[model samples]
Target: MILEVAILDVKPDLTEDFESTFKAASKIIASISGYISHDLHRCLETKNRYILLVRWQKLEDHTIGFRQSPEYQEWRSLLHHFYDSFPTVEHYESIILP
Candidate 1:
């Protein structure tokens, strides 16, 4: 499994708007192939910062399957510009844990 993570810093004033947009957009992404699960959360210490975590069966499921789909285009259009800066997205695999 792979975890796709994005750390976003949205404009302070746009936090509520951004969260609403994200809630709608999540349904679109949730239905894609290899998409196992997902969650969106805000930093309690800093409301402007958000962390998005998506679990997938494979990396291609997110990169190729979702991004190339037409639905993704619409999803992007609905929720892309709320960010104050470019969202920093990265992939991860579980490592040593207690």
Candidate 2:
């Protein structure tokens, strides 16, 4: 499995609206191939900082599978503008667990 984490720093006033839009956006991604699960996390120190944590069977499942789908445009439209800066997305593989 691959884990994709997107760290976003949104404009403060846009937080609530962004969250509302994400709810709708998540549904679109959920329908895509290899989507396992996802959750959104907001920073306690600042509400404008968010991390989108998602799991997929493979990195391509997100990079190619979802992004190539028509639904990607909708997801982009819903959540893209809220970011104060371009989100930093990184992929990781689990190697250890207690």
Candidate 3:
């Protein structure tokens, strides 16, 4: 599985609007192939700051399947405006230990 993470800094006064919009945008992402689940977390130290964590079956499921799909455009349109700056998204794989 792949874990996708993004740190989103919303416009100072738009956190409430951003949250509501995100609730709507969530459906678009969840509909994608290989999507396992996702979560949005708000920062206590910074009200406008948020973290998005998404689980996917594979990397391409997000990079190619979702980003390249028409649903992505809707996702962008719904939530992109709230960002103060474009967020950098990264993916990770779990490490196993003995």
Report the number of the highest-lDDT candidate.
3
lDDT (tens digit, per residue) of candidate 1 on 11-37:
999999999888889889988989999
TM-scores, each model vs. reference: 0.91, 0.95, 0.97
Tell me which residue pairs clash in candidate 1.
Answer: none
lDDT of 3 by residue, 29-98 (tens): 9999999999999999998999999999999999999999999999999999999999989999999845
Instruction: Point out where model 3 deviates above 4 Å.
Output: none
Q: Please give the distance, in angstroms, between residue 9's alpha carbon in candidate 2 and its true position after superposition.
A: 1.1
lDDT of 2 by residue, 1-98 (tens): 99999999999999999999899898999999999999999999987999999999999999999988898888888888999999999999999976
Name the lDDT of candidate 1: 0.91
Q: How do the candidates rank by TM-score, highest first?
A: 3, 2, 1
* Residue 58 error, candidate 3, Å: 0.1
Please tell me which model should have the higher TM-score, number 1 or number 2.
2
Clash numbers, per candidate: 0, 0, 0
Better of 2 and 3 by TM-score: 3
Highest TM-score: which candidate? 3
Q: Model 2 scores what on Cα lDDT?
A: 0.94
